[model samples]
Target: MLFFSGKGGVGKSTVTAAMALLAAQQGKRVLVVDVDAKGNLTDLFEHEPVGFKPVEVHPGVHVMTMHTEESLQEYLRLNLRVPVLGRIGPLARALDFVATAAPGVKEILTVGKVCWEVRESIEGRADWDVVLVDAAATGHIVAQLGAPEAIRDLVSVGPVRAQTEWMSDLMHDPAVTALNVVTTPEEMPVNETIELVGRVRSELQVPLGAVIVNRVLPELFTHADEETFEAMRDPAAVNRLVDALGGGPDVARGTTAVLDAARMAVSLRRTRAGHLAELRRAVDLPTLFLPYLFVREHGLRVTRMVAEALGEELGL
Candidate 1:
């Protein structure tokens, strides 16, 4: 299972969707699970409202939005071996109360469901080549993924303990699971990612797969362009350019706007480069870069372009 997580607004959903598409393109049965309540994956696929059941968004790519209530009911139905209880009202409400009252119980149900999928297969063949979880942001992801271990420690001798133990093993096994931390090449996002890597390594003991740098700005200015900009800082150079462009107030204003935009672009690129360098120095993981999409709105077409670029980057 490949779990993708990052700060909110880091475009982790887009990255997860793109990677799922790439996996499907490679003929893998891919399940893209959106654990976030925001249903960002639903938006990315432009699909009808996704419920508990898995919906095929692409050829071999299935998407599902995980809800805590549904996950709890499924967990009880499977573990208790009483399918009727999962549907009945009084039992369902009682189970919901227990899940809500207990901290991390809801999370355990959710993560346990994911682990169950990882361990299941059809006719000795793996059910899914990859289970890509578009998990919650960094603040809550560690707790969500660590739910099994927490429950295991608390419940020493019971069926719940046994279940959590299995889930924990699946998560901790380097061969079975890995985490991908996504971030933009910016200060706070990079800092949060670095911290998240540390926690995942030391606390969760999960294998770190890769650090994905999303929405990286393209470096458009050359060294000569920088020199030209420096020269344009002079009033004489600005006047000359305005005169060359038919010497009017409008021409002067246009020249100023163009220079300002160029300068802003250069500044932004430098900032992103510095953050990328810092991320490399601090986090010891393979870092993948995804370019910023310059579209008015993101849709299936743009997602495909991102998937193609990501495929090339990861050699998928």
Candidate 2:
């Protein structure tokens, strides 16, 4: 089970989707759990919004959107042997009310369901080669994942405790479960990712997977190439290049435009390099960088593009 979490807008869903695609390409059966509640991961696969039940979006890939209420329902039915709330009226609503006062109740519902699926896959009841989770944002993932431990602390003995024991067993085993954080090479995202890694190490039993740095701006030039760029930007060289391009009416303006873009690209890359360096210094985890994609839109096409890049990075 691979749980992907990161600061919002750091391409968490995109990275998870890409990994699903990558695993599928490797002929692995992947179950993608969209825990973000946006249900947007299915959109990338061009599928309609899904509920708690898993839906096959692509060949060898299935998706499910987490719904705590439904998760609770499934939990009750499976563990308590309750027949879809037949005995208890509005049990889900009751959970919502109880969740307001109880911290881990709601979180357990989500995380428990995720772990349950993983357990099924691991025990051969379900045929999932990989369970890739598009987990909650960084702000909530710690609480989300640590819910089982919290619940175990609060409830000393019960079916819940029994269930959480096995879940914790799966979580602490590095060979079975891993949590990966996705981030861009930017200030807030990198800071949050570093903080997250620290918190995960201190507070959670889940094993740390690689830090996937997304949207990393590519280095546009080497030292010698940079010197050449500087020389080309010299006014005389610019004038000569304009002359070489026929020096027509808008020749100088076009030359200036291209130079400005190249300058911005180099400047952005340098600034991002500092943040990447900070991440490397602070977080002692395997890091994978995905290049900033220059695209007009996102979908399976872009997802496949990212998957290809990710596959290459994973040496697939």
Candidate 3:
């Protein structure tokens, strides 16, 4: 089981899709689970996947949406066999109450659905070599992961308890599960990534697979280019440019002409590299760097690029 988790808007869905597609290409049947409330994974694929049912979004790629309410209703009706207090309309209200009032009940139900998928995948009944979960952002990831444990602790003497315990064990098992934290080269993301790595180690005790640094800028300047850039910035160089251009003693225009947009791009690239290096040192995890994608929209092209990056990083 491979989990792509991080803060919101960190391209977890993108990474999950790329990994799943690559896994499928490698002859491993793959299922990409959309566990986020926003259903971002569905958007990455071309097809729409209904909640709680696996849909083939691509060849060798199955997709499923995990909704808290749907999981809760399924659990209550099928597993718990609790007759509803009212009709469908009122059932929604009751579910809403349980979702909010019970605290972590929704989380448990959602996680239980994922646990079912994992178990099914292991049984060889499903045509999936791996289950890729595009999990929720950092804000709710902890509660989501702890859901099985919560249910296990709450009901200690029943079938539900037994099932929850099994799921909890699966989550805590390092051999079966791996968590990858996605981050960018910015301050907020790097800080959050460091904190998340520590939390996963201290709390979940799960192995931290790698820190995926997305949208990293390429270093365009070689050592010779750096020397040229530095020399161009010297005052004497500016004076030479003024003489060469014959710009009537306008040093600002001459200097500005020499320092074009390439200088800013070079500077920004260096700054981004510095941030990435700092994050690498702080986390001490294998950092996979993905190039900055200049596409107008994200689609299979970006997904393929991500897969290539993963392949290079994993040496597969």
Candidate 4:
């Protein structure tokens, strides 16, 4: 089981989907679970609305959206062995009220469902070869994954405590679970990723698989290229280039645009390099970099490209 998480807009869902595709390509029976409310994974595959039940999007990839309420109901049915309670309206509403009133209860239900799926089996064989979870943003994912311990502290004995302990075991077991934190090479996101790594290692005790750095800007201008441009920055060279293009306002504007674009690219690359250096210093996990996609929009084609790139990075 792998949980993908990062701050919002860091392309967490996109990376999760790409990894799922790569896993499927490797002949693993993969189930991609979306715990984020946005449900972007559904849109990525152009699938119909996903609910609690798993829907097969590709030949070997199945997708599902995990609703907290539905997960609570399933938990009740499984633990209480009362199927009708899960379907009954009043019982469901009452359980929802309790989940809402209690802190981390809903999180436990959500994450517990994921843990259950990871340990699920048929005839002594695992049901799926792997489970990929597109989890919520950093803060929420921390709270959610920490729910088992929180509830364990609150409820000392009973089924709730027992179940939470079981979930915690599965979560902290290095052989069964791994976490991947995604982030862009930006100030706030990289800082958050660093803090998240510390907490996951210290507080959660979960083994981290990797840090995925997404949407990195390529280094287009080397130091030599910058020096060359700096030498041509004089007014005489500018005028010569403009005159060579007919000396019109459009020519000057086009030249300025090209220079501005190059400058911007260089600035972005430098900033990202600094952030990458910080990540290397602070994070102790394997770091994988994915270049920014220049496509008009992200779709299956782009997803496959990212998956292929990621597979290469992982030597798969």
TM-scores for candidates 1 onward, in order:
0.92, 0.97, 0.85, 0.93
What shift in Å separates residue 123 of candidate 1 from its native position after superposition?
7.0
lDDT of 3 by residue, 242-292 (tens): 777775757667567658766877888888777777787888887787777
Name the runs in model 3 displaced over 4 angstroms.
Answer: 48-50, 76-89, 233-259
lDDT of 4 by residue, 53-158 (tens): 8989877889989887778767777788767743567866787898777778888988898888887842245568889999878887778889999888878789
Q: For this target, which candidate reaches the highest TM-score against the unseen true structure?
A: 2
- With a 3 Å backbone cut-off (N, CA, C), the pairs that clash in candidate 3 are 29-129
Instruction: For candidate 1, write residues 1-316 as lDDT tens digits.
Output: 9999999998999999999988888899998888986866867777766887788887888988898777767776778876765356776678789877776787887788788888884224457888999988999888889898878777769888888877888888889889999999999999999999999878897788999999988888688978877898689999999999999999999999998888888899999999999999999899899998888887788779889989889887
lDDT of 3: 0.77
The worst-scoring run of ten residues by lDDT in candidate 2 lies at 84-93
Candidate 2: list runs displaced more than 4 Å.
Answer: 85-89
Q: On TM-score, who's better, 2 or 3?
A: 2
Judged by lDDT against the true structure, how good is candidate 4? 0.85
* Model 3 clash tally, residue pairs: 1
Native-structure RMSD, model 1: 2.0
On lDDT, the candidate that comes out on top is 2
